[model samples]
Target: MSSSAPNAVLSVSGIGKTYAQPVLSNIDLTLLRGEVLALTGENGAGKSTLSKIIGGLVTPTTGQMLFNGRAYTPGSRTQAEELGIRMVMQELNLLPTLSVAENLFLDNLPSHGGWISRKQLRSAAIEAMAQVGLDAIDPDTLVGELGIGHQQMVEIARNLIGDCHVLILDEPTAMLTAREVEMLFDQISRLQARGVAIIYISHRLEELARVAQRIAVLRDGNLVCVEPMANYNSEQLVNLMVGRELGEHMDMGVRTIGAPALTVKGLSRADKVLDVSFEVRAGEIFGISGLIGAGRTELLRLIYGADIADSGTVALGSPAKVADIRSPVDAVRHGIALITEDRKGEGLLLTQSISANIALGNMPAISSAGLVNGRDESALAQRQIDAMRIRSSSPDQLVCELSGGNQQKVVIGRWLERDCAVLLFDEPTRGIDVGAKFDIYALLGELTRQGKALVVVSSDLRELMLICDRIGVLSAGRLIETFERDSWTQDELLAAAFAGYQKRDALLHEAAPRNTL
Candidate 1:
């Protein structure tokens, strides 16, 4: 499809981008009105670059874009939006300090005589929030206080506010719950009905088949395939994305299970995390499965001392001696490491070079007498880059310039330098690609082989099943149940995840007074 096509809402020809080197090249694609186009590829394959070009976040080195048959050149995101072209990027574009209502209507505030109309803003925000299943949340609540999943929904809602001719969603459901994802799909259907052109970008192949009418696959900066989505299966799509057939079964290698290396007893933190307790053995990967508000991330934060536990004890080693962990520094000193879910916000210093980011925590080895050893710092980063297969020009490349999956690799690479006995990974592969996910899985297996206990929290139950020795389900801030790999089923895990919430709801119902007329 080209710009000349009658129904084409947007089209790009000879689209290419280069930064230090060519990241995208010679891409020709068209978006039809009221049709969903699925754009997918491995990380660094130029999916984001192409979307950014179309969305006006980045300028293409060589190319031309046509919007409804007219030449379109967007110099800034504001310019693009003004022309009814909007995008919800993978990296959130939100003001943390602002209230949800304020962020949603920041560009076009409802005002009268230079005064903001609080009533109008709240009403509009509530209507938008309800579309994404955020009706229960107060519009005046600060965005920073909401979980990553909620924040992602807020970003989506903001884009859907005004007249939107073209909407590009880049990994929109990465942090969303299954229910939240359903809500998003429902909204997508409504948008389709309204004749909105959508470019849905995601690594989740199943999602592409579900939502997109046509599929466009990119590989190594080149457009490889553009066909009806039904023509290819998930496995076939994966093969196209990575340029190789990936086996269904993973090779975790041989490893021996050992004694309990990390133990949490009676962990509680107000209503968010309630009396959560578990033990992770050396040479074992303990997986945490839960819904978005089920307190999975909060539990991990408590264990890592990112947040203090109101009442709990964290212990390390065979005999289970309690460790006093009040902060991240204390946790690190005690040989505990946490790979946070919000990689951009919490994990990496985006402006810094890859070498500098990797050398952040491992300064002791890379520095001498307060003077940093440049050779040692570079070597430390180079070792992990090679190990993690991080795609970059060199160690000096800034983390912000790298792709999302590659940036995640740098975050993992930083922790690999430390010989932490217990590692906690919170949505480690949240926005990563399939091939890179396997790489991290292999790394986890290696850690287990080294007798390091690993705790992985993931929204994907299949992911937990694939890499975990035992899976523990968190429900309404409680550890509902823990099942061995062979003993657990998907349905069983999901039931356990909702068990706490169900019980709580039942109790609340019984406590409420009933009026009889």
Candidate 2:
């Protein structure tokens, strides 16, 4: 007796999971040969858990799966790899100590006797890297030397190596440039032609619509919808994922922009940032957009005093004057708060309780005569949490257990609890779902309403366009142009984003001279 579904490469039935709480329940999905199925939902919605289970990284508490029309349960990631299942996790899996060649062929290094074949390694590495459009990177380069985007490419290349029946890519384009993303889509097409089953998970909804043939939406551990990607518009898909009606577009709300609240003049740091000057007004949402490595983050770090500037002035206030921001402590003393891109590293104390993490930043305010006021601290946490709408069981819950979006909210909430007059956000909505992103945008709106100045740096061009009153495009560490909300178009902004990367001086020098705050 043979199964009727001959083309089904993977079939999951009654799949469920639990970890200190019920995460997933009664989920079913199918991956046919040569088709791209997208799984999307808010963070902690069990999408990652499902993909992890399929990749043998986590054990499902309840479920049965059939692979190639047979009962399949992999004991480990290695076992899954042996069975031709691969997962490219959002957090990169490459070893920094190893060379790109070594990381690519870590499990099965080519060797004769006991001696590794460097020649053969480079040859094989180049081919695989080229497959993923990484032809420029030398095979012998250390993985640590590469930037985040290039590292992501290496991870993808590693997964595409040998015997890949099923490939699961989690937020694959999160760090990639627009050009690299197109390259990835091309590779996906090539793989599909060879009958590979691909599962793509991304927070960027538009990418899913473009690349996936079918979409499976999961929300709060339950499968909400599964259908051809063609059937659902962006709004419908977002509605299914977050269980709410949301417009796919954002309009500039009426907000009064006032005197300069934060100002940087001639900001320069080695070659990472150069002669950058800008002013962000009170109640103004100023956005900075650029390609990766274009000095946006470096510039923010300089203003926040996370990094030192060679020669520049940073100021904060309604009537701004140069403030000596020699360190983050100095910056904080002048009412400046920076929500870093690396949330897990610089933003949150993950192992601590949510209340404690939020309370950590404002100890002086929460303390009475140096003795901790437990009640005031808890109240403070609850206040910001409510305002931010951070989803958590209670303030007592550990920050580590919450989703990416919630963790981000906690970081922002901590800063919000302070008396900061200026907030600088770097990739503020990175790893956040569409619904949560809107929530953040709304939160930003509220902050501006309170007359707190904001400087946001983002890789997402449209996100900046949606939220910012003014948008500045940085090129090769230079503030090439800054455009007012009424003065910019999407195509113009996109052209400016790639200005530094366009391989010509004409593009590098283009744009309106600059905009006054």
Highest TM-score scorer: 1
Over the full model, what C-alpha lDDT does candidate 2 score relative to the true structure?
0.87
> Tens-digit lDDT track for model 1 on 1-517?
6578888999999999988899998999999999999998898888888988888889999989999889999999999999999999989989999999999999999999999999999999999899888988899999999999999999999999989999999999999878889999999999999999999999887888999999999998999999998898888889977888887688888989899999999999989999988999999999999999999999989988999999989999989999999999999999999998898789999999999999997989889899999999999999999998998999999999999889989998898868899999998888788888898899989989999999999988888999999999999999999999899999999899889999999998898887643
Q: For all the candidates, what are their Cα RMSDs to the real structure?
A: 1.2, 5.1
Counting only residues 3 or more apart in sequence or on different chains, how many pairs clash (N, Cα, C under 3 Å) in candidate 1?
0
Q: Predict model 1's lDDT versus the native.
A: 0.92
Looking at model 2, residue 84 earns an lDDT score of 96
Question: All candidates' lDDT scores?
Answer: 0.92, 0.87
Clashing residue pairs for model 1: none
Lowest lDDT block of 10, candidate 1: 508-517
lDDT of each residue in 85-201, candidate 2, tens digit only = 999986678898899999999999999998999999999999999998888889999998776678889999999999999999998887776878999999999999999999999
